[model samples]
Target chain A: MKAIEIDNLSKSYNKGKVQALSSVSFEVERGELFGLIGPDGAGKTTLFRLLTTLLSPDAGRATVDGYDIVKEYHAIRSRVGYMPGRFSLYPDLSVEENLQFFAALFGVNVEESYDLIAPIYKQIEPFRTRRAGKLSGGMKQKLALSCALIHRPSILFLDEPTTGVDAVSRSEFWDMLAGLKERGITILVSTPYMDEASRCDRIALCNEGRILGIDTPHDIVRGFDNRLYGISAKNMFTLLERARAMEGVVECYPFGQRHHLVADDSFSVEQFTRQLSDIEGLEIASAEPTIEDMFIKLMKR
Target chain B: MNSEIVISVRELTKRFGDFTAVDRISFDVHRGEIFGFLGANGAGKTTAMRMLCGLSYPTAGSGSVAGFDVMREGEKIKRHIGYMSQRFSLYNDLTVWENMRLFAGIYGLNRRETEERASALLKRLNFEAERDTLVGSLPLGWKQKLSFAIATIHRPEVVFLDEPTGGVDPVTRRQFWELIYEAASEGTTIFVTTHYMDEAEYCSRVSIMVDGEVRALDTPARLKQQFAAESMDEVFRTLARGAQRGE
Candidate 1:
């Protein structure tokens, strides 16, 4: 049986006026690191809540660890670990106390799962006596992850774990997740950062109550339908405006050091090169689409 | 790059009790420059920004923003700078038009000026239809764009945007950058912070803070070359990985 399975799941709020999730469906294999990639309010959290059995779906059904989500919620709760996007840990409690309290609630001793959470917990163990609220953003993140894993859950669900985290800490957090996956634990993580999609074994690109696509990061990039070009000039702002105004240009958006420009078959590189030759420090090269590029295209469709 | 300096700091420091949040950081931002201030969490980026914005006073050192002293002329500094953060800066309960009026009034604009600016802003954003709608009801992307627009409504000499595009989609993120460029083009210096490395590359110059100090500051190309890295992300990781103080 799959670690998680959902069929036609839908949810709404404010008396059906707000649709948070719309007929979302997917599955996660045991021990696989799955990613739910999307921006804020993309229904990532809504789906997690439904699968974790915190809330009932408005339609359809789901199961986790071979148990019905609604009918066997108690079984799933004890079996799966959930780390909410917010800092839900007790702010007043010390790091050690918080971990102990969570472990006790799940009827397990800290020693029982020390091996499972030691790698993360040990980094924060020096500050075990510190209040959870007093910890820094990165330290707090580490503490939260330790607590979520203290119960030795078979599956882990992390919601936007790196939303406001810095680049360095964000990279470290992914490395921790990768470590957990290697220990035969199935992890379902969500993040708003597109670059993180590459870290997951498979990802579901979600947006505004819908899933845009589901595939490996590499395959998704390969699925891009257009020939993209990266163009950069002294004045990027003016370049964006001019590129978009040029004939045959389908799309143009800033990507890091250069602007990713997509043009139709009618686009003549030789002719455009002559037209743009006068611009100072101009460089244009064939570019490969990233997951972010594919995501924008999917949203447009 | 030759524009007049709008923000200048030397040996700027902020300390609380035994902890030093910002320690002797110094830099200069030119007029109309999009200066990217970046760092790991708890690396003093916020503390330094607060000092510059006149929200918090520094414990030591000297600085000036928009030609006003950071320590003695905080009120003047506040008047000449605009600020917008992803977490706060908007009135969710108020309609789009009402929020505009509120901010404009606070910025000391006259009724006639508020009306004119509000209509022009709405039209430029093609958001005239949503003028009466409450800001809370709009999508996150729309709300973020509106917040930036309102932050610059007074045409301040410098605008500080704190992670203004944190969780927006790719397309909307680009749109936000377009707005930043537009504001800079009009001579509104942009002092922005973001975790997005790509956004870092967009800036004319960037400063990466580590352990309560400005460790690296240069143009994106120069920084990349100096660090021998292909992208800003690598440079950031190289500098931030050694940070001992992280929250």
Candidate 2:
């Protein structure tokens, strides 16, 4: 049996005015690192709440570790660790106190799970006496992960762990997740960052509560069939407008220093260059499609 | 390339007791330039921005924003620039039209000018139909776009965006940049901060803060080459990795 199984799970709020999740379904293999990649309001959190049994789905059924989410809520809650999008540790409690509290709540002591959380906890161990709220963002993240793992959950659900964090700290958080994954924990994480999609074994590109596509980051890029090019000029704004106006150009988007222009086979580079010959310092090159490119393409469709 | 300098700082410093939050940062942002101000969390990017925005008084150094002296003309400086952030930029309960009118009024725009600007902005955003809709009801992407329009409504000489695209979707994030480019082309000097390295590359020039200092400042192309990194992310990582602070 799969570590997780969902069949057409649906959820909504405000008497169906919101429709937070719409018939979402996916599976997770045991000890696999799966990612839910999407921006805010993409229902990533809704799905997490449903699987964690915090809220019953409006329709459909799901199971974690062969246990029905609704019927086996107790089993699921005890076996799964969740780090919400927001920092949720007690502000008044010291780092060590919070860990001890969580462990005791689960009928275990800190020493029982010290081996499971030591890798993450040791970094913040020096601050054991500091209030959880007083720690820095990076240290706070480590503490939250440590508290979540104090019970040694078989599966982990991290919702937007890297949101609002700097790139350096985000990379560090992912490294911690990787370490946790190696301990044979089934991990399901969500992020709004397209760049972090590459770190996941498989990702579901979600938007507006719908899964656009689900595949390995490599396979998703390989699935992009359009001929995309990176085009830049002295005036990037004008370049974007001109690229969009040209016939056969499907989409033109500003990507970092240059614009990623998607074109059909009918488009010819020679003709494109000839058309924009008047534009100065123009540079064009075939570009590789990234996860962001694929996510945008899939979301549009 | 010699555009007029709109924002100039020299040895600008901000301190709280013994801790120096912004330490001797110096840079000049030219007119109509999109200048990216980047740094890790708790690296003093906020303190420096607060000083430039005339919100917090600096401990030492000299600077001017939109030609207003930072030490003396803080209120005058605030009047000449616009500011927006992902959070707290808009009121949830207010309708789009109401929000626009509120900001326009706060900026001291006359009644006629406010109406004209509102109509033009609504048209540009294709949001005329939603004028009466509550801002809280709009999607995250739409709210951000609307916030940008409102921030620039006064047509200030400079506008500062604080991570305006954080948590926004990919498609809408690009759309936000187009709005930024349009504003810059209209001769508005944009001072922005972001964690997205790709967005950093969108700037005409970028200044990265490390330990309260302007550690790296250059065009994205030059910075990448100087750091021997392939992407802005790599360059940022190289500079930020050496920081002594832990956030």
Candidate 3:
């Protein structure tokens, strides 16, 4: 059975001045890890909110575990775990208390759900007496996840769960989510980080409330038809300017220290480098394209 | 990497009632380098930055930012350092130039100096044309770039960016980092926090915080090698588990 199914889902805010979601429709296979990838104002959060039934959609419909999103809102809330982008685990309660409260809210006890959160709980267990407000961003995130999972929901909706987290904490957080996937819970996570998209089983590229593309990370990159050349110079700004100025350079944008340049029909990497080397105080090198590169290309297209 | 340390922190701790937001952490931020300070949302990084910036007093610790003691000379530290918080800290009613001017006035920059600095920053950030655009009217990415510009209005020795690239697009983030690099090249120290591991790669060095403590601090390359991870994301995960194991 499909874990999630949404058809022509559309939502807006500010009296329709802001269209939060426009015909966002997709399906999450049972036990699959799905990512909603986009930048700010890209409707990622809105979509997540709608899926969780925090906000009613202006048009269309969605279902979690085949339960109607609007009519079965209460049922959906119980069957699905949602950790919002912000840290909302009760601030006054201790780590354990917050988890217990959430478990109770779902008509379960911490003992009944403790196994689900054991790996993460152990880290913050020592600080179980510590107030949620006092916990670190990473800890709060973990706590939120634990609360979401207390009910052993059929599906999980994590809205940018790894955002605003340390690199190490983010790494651990994804691992935890990956572990959760083993139990066959469909996970729908949205993140602003393009790199995180690859870790998902599949991803929907969103921009300005529109679904730009949806496919597995590898498939999306494979679909990119452009020839990519990565180039770097002593000065990034000058290199960018030169690439933009270069003949037949389709897209010249900085990826890191180096810049990735997509070529037109006539543009060649060797020839492009040869011309770029003539520029003073520049270091040019070839590079591989990442998911960020793919998104840049898609956005441009 | 320098003889003169821009910031020297020792045994930094912050407590709200019984909670330890920052638990006796310490680190040194050198001059003229991009330093990445990373943590989760409530990891106390913001609290620590606030303490270092003199906006919040550390419950206990001894630190000097830009040669001014955080405890004794907090006002002086504020004057010598700039901070861009995670939230859009600028006034929405103000124009880009107006925000810059307001910050300049607070930082004690002269009118001519403020104009020269604001114009230069705006030009570098490619928002010179949008200088008159109301900050509220601008997009999320533009506002982020503008906030960074205003934070450093006084040309402080060290600038703190609390997740400066939180929700902006990749293209704008790249542009913002260019500004940071330029500032670093010109002898300014950048202390930034970000969730994007790719952004962490650009820093000369990065430190990961877990539960109000520095879990790992080193160059991104070194951390990656030590963790035996292909990317920063894995490095973070491996270290988080290690921290969990250690505890």
Candidate 4:
């Protein structure tokens, strides 16, 4: 059975001045890791809020584990876990207290659900006595995840869980999420970082409150139709402008120190090299398309 | 390229009672160079930046920024440097032009100069239409761009960006880096801290802090080579896997 389903979901704020979600629809299969990938203000948070029953959608319908979102919110609430983008745990409370409080609210004891949260909780267990406010960003996120899982929900919604975290912490967080998926939990995560999208089982590319595309990370990158070339020179800024103005160049944008240039059918590496031969320290080579490149192309389309 | 050292530090230390937030860290930032400060959460990166920016006093050791002593010349240091934090620091209620005018005033620019510079900056950023719009209403990317512009309005010798690209998209991030590059090209030294490993590759040199100490410091290529890693992310993981803090 599907873990969750949405049909014609729509929402607006500021008296319809902002169309937060525009008739969005998608499905997450049972035990799948689903990712909502987009930039900020792309309706990611609104969609999560709607699924978690925190906000009512203006139109359309959605169901969590076969329960209608609006009419059966109470029942849905007990079956799912949610970690908001912003840190929401009580600052004055110690890490242990926050976990206990969340467990009690769910009518469960920490010992009763200890096994479910052990992998994540163990990382922050050493700092259990520390106040939630004093914990670091990565530790705070781990604590929040543990609290959310203390009740052993079958489904989890994490909104930008790895944002503003160091590279090491981010990889560790993903490893924890993957472990959770192994226990047959349906997970829905949202992030602005394109690299994280590859870690998900499937991703929905969102923009301006709409899903631009939905597919596996590999499939999304494979969908890019243009030949891309990575080009660089002594002065990268000048190289970007020059490449953008060149003929047969469809799109050009900086990716790290190099510029990624998309070419048309008439484009050739030889012609491109000859065009900028005067430039010193020039380097050009064919490059593979990444998820970020695909997202930019989709947004432009 | 200016080989002059814009920021120099030696054995910089900061302590809160018995807790050592920063312990004997030292580094140098060169003029027109992008220096990245990286670390795990609660790894003393912020504490060290606070000391260098003169926002917090060191418990021991010494440092200098913009040729002024960090110990007794914080005011002089502030006047020669720009800083943009993770949070947008502009007044939300103020219009774009108003915020620009306010910052220009804070930087001691004359009324006529403020008006001219603000207009020119808005035009250059293609934000002329947002001149009268409240800064709160603009998108996150625009707000960040404007914040960077505001931070450097006085043309300080060096600019400190503390995770300035947090929550922004890849496209916008690339554009933001263009601004950083532009500033650096004009001889404005950039000392930045970021959590994004990919961003670390863009820096001329990077320092990774762990548990109040410098664990690794080198160019992105050299660090990756030294660690036998493919990317900065791997290098960081290899080093930070032994982090003493945050368990």
**Candidate 3, A37-142: lDDT as tens digits:** 8898999888888888888999999988988889999888889998888788889999888988888788888888778778878877888899999876667777
DockQ of 4: 0.67
lDDT for residue A213 in candidate 3, whole number 0-100 = 87
Query: Pairing residues by index, what is the TM-score of model 1?
Result: 0.98
lDDT score, candidate 2, position A100: 91
Residue A51 in candidate 1, Cα distance off native in Å: 0.9
C-alpha RMSD for every candidate: 1.0, 1.0, 4.2, 1.6
Model 3 regions lying over 4 Å from their true place = A94-97, A108-130, A234-237, A278-286, B1-32, B37-72, B110-133, B204-247
* Count of steric clashes across candidates, in order: 3, 0, 11, 0
Q: DockQ of every model listed?
A: 0.88, 0.89, 0.43, 0.67
Per residue, candidate 2 scores C-alpha lDDT tens digits across B152-240 of: 89989999999999999999999999999898988899999998899999999999999999999999999999999999999999989
Instruction: Give lDDT: candidate 2, residue B150.
Output: 93
Off by over 4 Å in 1: none
The lDDT per prediction is 0.92, 0.92, 0.82, 0.90
Per-residue lDDT of B104 in model 4: 93
Instruction: For candidate 1, write residues A1-301 as lDDT tens digits.
Output: 9999989999999999999999999999999999999998899999989889999989999999999999999999999999999999999999999999999999999998999898899999999999999998788888999989988899999999998899888998999999999999999999999999999999999999999999988898888988899999999888888888777789899999999988888887777777878777778889989999999999999
Worst lDDT run of 10 residues, candidate 3 chain B, spans B238-247
lDDT of 4 at B27: 85
